[model samples]
Target: MEIRQLEYFVAVAEEGSFTRAAERVHVAQPGVSAQIRRLERELGHDLLDRSGRAVTVTAVGAAVLPLARAALGSVESARRTVEEMAGLVRGAVRVGMVVSCGVMDVPELLAAFHTSFPGVEITLTEANSDELVSSLVDGRLDLALIGYAGPAPDGLAVRVLADEPLVVAVTDADPWRARESVPLDELLERGVICLPPGTGLRGALDEACGTRRPRIAFEVSAPPMVITLARRGLGPAVLAASMVPPDLHAVRITDPVPSGALAFAWRAEGPHSPAARALIGLAENRVTAP
Candidate 1:
């Protein structure tokens, strides 16, 4: 009967679980159940079969599903049209960021955008660069701050935030601490600490090493943890130059400098929502690439 109840019905039917539908709509399970119950009462028919573990829609519900979706889409389109005419931006923006992102102040950028458009909802997700790229391509996310190496992925445009050489971080106790730079061969010979595969830093390292492989002494998911393990004398760590602290020495890896980039990426065609465009625009205004 109500718009939200129809939304709940559609979500529950698609997700096959009330819990999952609740999560997808950012609502409580009980509230979703109550709304659907109220709607079913008004309709005088069971919309969903809750007898099994996975919920399934009744024949009546299946018949109404397409109509419900169309109605929701129409409402959204009308809202967007009115907002556009009034020169106001209000919508949801799904953003993804790579893990261990220390290159830029992302919080500041997000806060500024929120302050400017308080009505717009922002959902932020953290993932590795490769996963984030896939999410962007699939339209799961509107924008992403991702770390990458070599060429940009297809069907995406980027604003580079940090483009720096990947370096080996060593503690003072390590013999390589005094060195200005180390070659890929020496790094393979001595062994090195590294982030797991699929990370931008690791991608750069793999590209630089070519057919040759490095001796991976330890693998850590977090960049900070990689530095911590290396500092404890586990092994020299491979990471972005800027990630190395003053206490630890950064020895640039050469024989082709392995370079990693932190960038804000979106679809080549651009974002569907004004909120996403506004957020990226705000970031562009504030962020200065290093």
Candidate 2:
């Protein structure tokens, strides 16, 4: 019933261990367990089932967790609003970014935002487009830089930042290094090192290749790993043109120039904090390439 109780519950639920949650929240383990017991008694239902050092949320816990999270978020937002009124632009902004965006846009955006608002705390998480979208919807991220795909989330606003063309990255010693541009069909036959599903660029490549089915020799999750694998002559990788590492050479896909847009998205219904607004402004202005 108390805000503190909800906080403890959420911490335990997320960490899945009472000891870990206590460590994270800087509380004694026994204190955390006592609080949880008190909370369950007040709610008249068990929230978590602990067995053999593993914990799982009970049905009632699953039902209440989201509501508890929302309540805590609201409380934090209110505190932030008051702090803002006192000329203190201090609040955490959680950002979810695709790997390509992390390489291409995040550094500049972070620099600009930090320079402009030093007091605002920033937390960045790198994830694929699908993970970013899901995190944004679940209130884990304040905003996300993701690849443009189908319809936006029902109540979210999206701003397209850049359209990054797809390119084939290969080792300098590879035979494809001699080519200025390569056909999409030819590249497919040459084998492609692709990112696993859920990445924005991977989805774009899939759409572009259609039924041709590029031979995937290896699947990598990180952009740098993909480049490293390609550099070792594992195979060519499909990636945003801007994400090609300096050491690697990239060839344009000429037959069908596949590309995807990078976008900044946030909840349309929620009030935008000053820090969030400032970050968005920076992303819009600084994301353009020279």
Candidate 3:
């Protein structure tokens, strides 16, 4: 029969009174009664016991009640599914990235997502890895690309783009340049150029060094700047192996070498918008570690 007939029948069966069911369904009492009557006629069974003041359900109506509710639930679920997809046509997604998080091309990922969902707005934030992770945990960002060491932060779902060791990037004039790797003792003899404390590369270095503070000759946020200063022979720059310039020797740090990783993170339990979900799907294809 008609879906409306089923809806009216279910409403009356629950309310136990045609008057209350009409108010609940926003239909006139006569219309509610007529539809339920039609539904019963189709089934050739008395769906309600009108003899009772409370409008008790007939044996047939008792069995059909549960089935009618299930049908309504399925319809509502389908309607919601369509609305969620339609929502992707226009929405916004917030993204955060570490400074010089060049392990993956974030702009390229966003470009692809935009191409697919042109109406979706995107907001970008540039911060150190520590801050990016914090924003993700705080629900301020939908997704993030970051450089990190050791395990990922708790409560985030991560996709590791690249995992490699930290290195001592030194100019040829530096004595350590000739070596494939240098121990912490030799590397610590002088101040080293490094990213600021909040960065992942710096965090990795700090973890490796422990209580003995490594001398900081230069503290810069950008990896390119770290490379530029190291090229000028300021001091050895501690950087991820992948970020070391070809002009400089990438001497792996020894005496417990620290590793770094480039990764994408999102909330493990997400209230992700359709647009955000679409962007995450495109990120897998657009971002690749060198």
Candidate 4:
């Protein structure tokens, strides 16, 4: 019922033991147990099953955990918002991005942010688009620079930052290296190295290839690994135009003109903290100007 009680309950649910949860929350074991008992009493339901040494959440507990988490997150966001209103400008921004952003835009953007808002801490998480979207929905990320393919998620704001062409990179020894522009159909017949289906680049490539399924010779999760596979002459790797490594020859895909748009996304209805707003403004300015 209380925020502290919910915190204790969540800690116990996560740690699976009162003693461990107490240690994590920096409270005594008996105190933690008492809090959980009080919370269960208030709700008139048994939240945890403590029949064995390993504690487990009851059905009621499982049902309420997500709501408790959301409530706690809302509280924290409110506190941070208040702090930002005082012009303190000291808070953390969690950003979710794809690997290409790390290679192409992250360094410059981070450097500029650090210079402009030294008091603000920036945390970066790189993953496939699916993971990024999941994080964004869970309130784990403040903003995300993700590949835009289909419609944006409901109740989220999306701003298209850049449009990057998808290029086929092959090793110097490969037969396609001498070509100026490869036909989309011919490229589809040749094997292509790609990330797994959940990756943003993979989705864009799949959409672009249309009916002719490209022969995928390698499936790698890391961008560098895909580039390495291409460098080894295994197969041509599909990557954003900006991610082309210097050692590999980047061949433009022409027929259908395969390209992907990058966009920044954030929760649409929530109170925007000053630091978040500043980062969003900086991102839009950087992407739009010059």
For candidate 3, the lDDT comes to 0.87
Q: Return the top candidate by lDDT.
A: 3
Clashes of 3: 0
Looking at model 4, residue 128 earns an lDDT score of 84
What TM-score does each of the candidates earn?
0.70, 0.60, 0.86, 0.62
lDDT of 2: 0.81
User: Whose lDDT is higher: candidate 1's or candidate 4's?
Assistant: 1
Alpha-carbon shift of residue 40 in model 4 (angstroms): 53
lDDT of each: 0.86, 0.81, 0.87, 0.82
- By lDDT, highest first, what's the ranking? 3, 1, 4, 2
**Residue range 1-290, candidate 2, lDDT tens digits:** 78888999999999999989999999999999999999999999999988757777899999999999999999999997786644326666889888744545576677777887788889999888888888887778888887854455466778877677899988878888888899888888877888888887787787787786778888888787888788788888888888888878889997788887778888776666767776777776655552
The alpha-carbon root-mean-square deviation between model 4 and the true structure, to one decimal in Å, is 14.4
lDDT of 2 at 63: 99
RMSD (Cα, Å) of model 2? 15.8
**lDDT for residue 15 in candidate 4, whole number 0-100:** 88
Runs of candidate 2 with Cα error greater than 4 angstroms are 1-90, 100-108, 111-119, 149-155, 245-247
lDDT for residue 25 in candidate 3, whole number 0-100: 91
User: Lowest-scoring 10 consecutive residues by lDDT in candidate 4?
Assistant: 83-92
Question: Top TM-score: which candidate number?
Answer: 3
Q: In candidate 1, which residue ranges exceed 4 Å CA deviation? A: 1-81, 85-90
